[model samples]
Target: MTGRENRRGRSRCREPQQSNHDVCVVPEEVSAHEGKPLYVLVALWCLKRGGWVNRGQIADAFGISERSATFQLTYLSRKKEQICCELRKVKRAGVPVESYEVRVTEVSPEAGVRKVSEKQREAVKTIQRGRVGNADGDVRELTRNIWNSLQRGRKA
Candidate 1:
């Protein structure tokens, strides 16, 4: 047996685990000048994670401060032309402030235009076709009669 192998009972191939060392190091923060588009993209990324993605995860992923994340999210909320996203503050122990969780809702790419789904269109058509009737017919007839009487009175 070699002198080194004899001296130590265990093999030297085994080494202590270095779990504390990060496999990848992310930067500290994102540049501030890029504006709100960055926030929208970040929000989308968070939502794509398949569940309620909180603000801290967003901040960590983007290498930004929580305050920056909040500001970006708030800006995203105000942009009428952008995708609709929801943010709710979550309260938990050891967190300095209530962190936000982002949920994406379906919205039209072009804002301020009527964008109704097929189901909604069918519902409207059904209503117009009298599948749904006004329970108070007397009230409706009275309003029509009042308009006719006014037209007659105007002629008289």
Candidate 2:
């Protein structure tokens, strides 16, 4: 066995892992950029993980400062319906850590976002069928009614 392997246990995987996930490594091409390119990498990571991905993992994978990682993550987190970024309390190695997750899609309804109910779904279907050159309802009133129907539920 190598001296380093002897010093550290062989079972210790060098790859960063959280829960059951192996963190994705940033591509060498990706590591070379500072702005939008890094943003793409962050987005890809979020999409791949399909849940919350942490900053330390991104930093280590890309050999970047956690600050840079945070900047990139925060940038992508702003695009609604595309990416959602939020701070969450998480336990890492049994210690609580403030973590961020960039969700590519909304798994849960966020604040200021509404969920559609049976009524809204029915309204939407009616709207779709009526939209084929038969839109007789006042646009403003129809919009308000649809909006109200969507916001009246807890995503059942």
Model 1 residue 125 CA deviation (Å) reads: 49
The digit string of per-residue lDDT tens for model 1 on 92-130 reads: 898686666767663334433356999998988776554
lDDT for predicted candidate 2 compared with the true structure? 0.54
Query: What lDDT does the true structure give each of the candidates?
Result: 0.54, 0.54
RMSD each, Å: 22.6, 19.0
Candidate 1: Cα lDDT at 121: 88
The prediction achieving the highest TM-score against the true structure is 1
Task: Mark the 10 consecutive residues where model 2 has the least summed lDDT.
Answer: 1-10
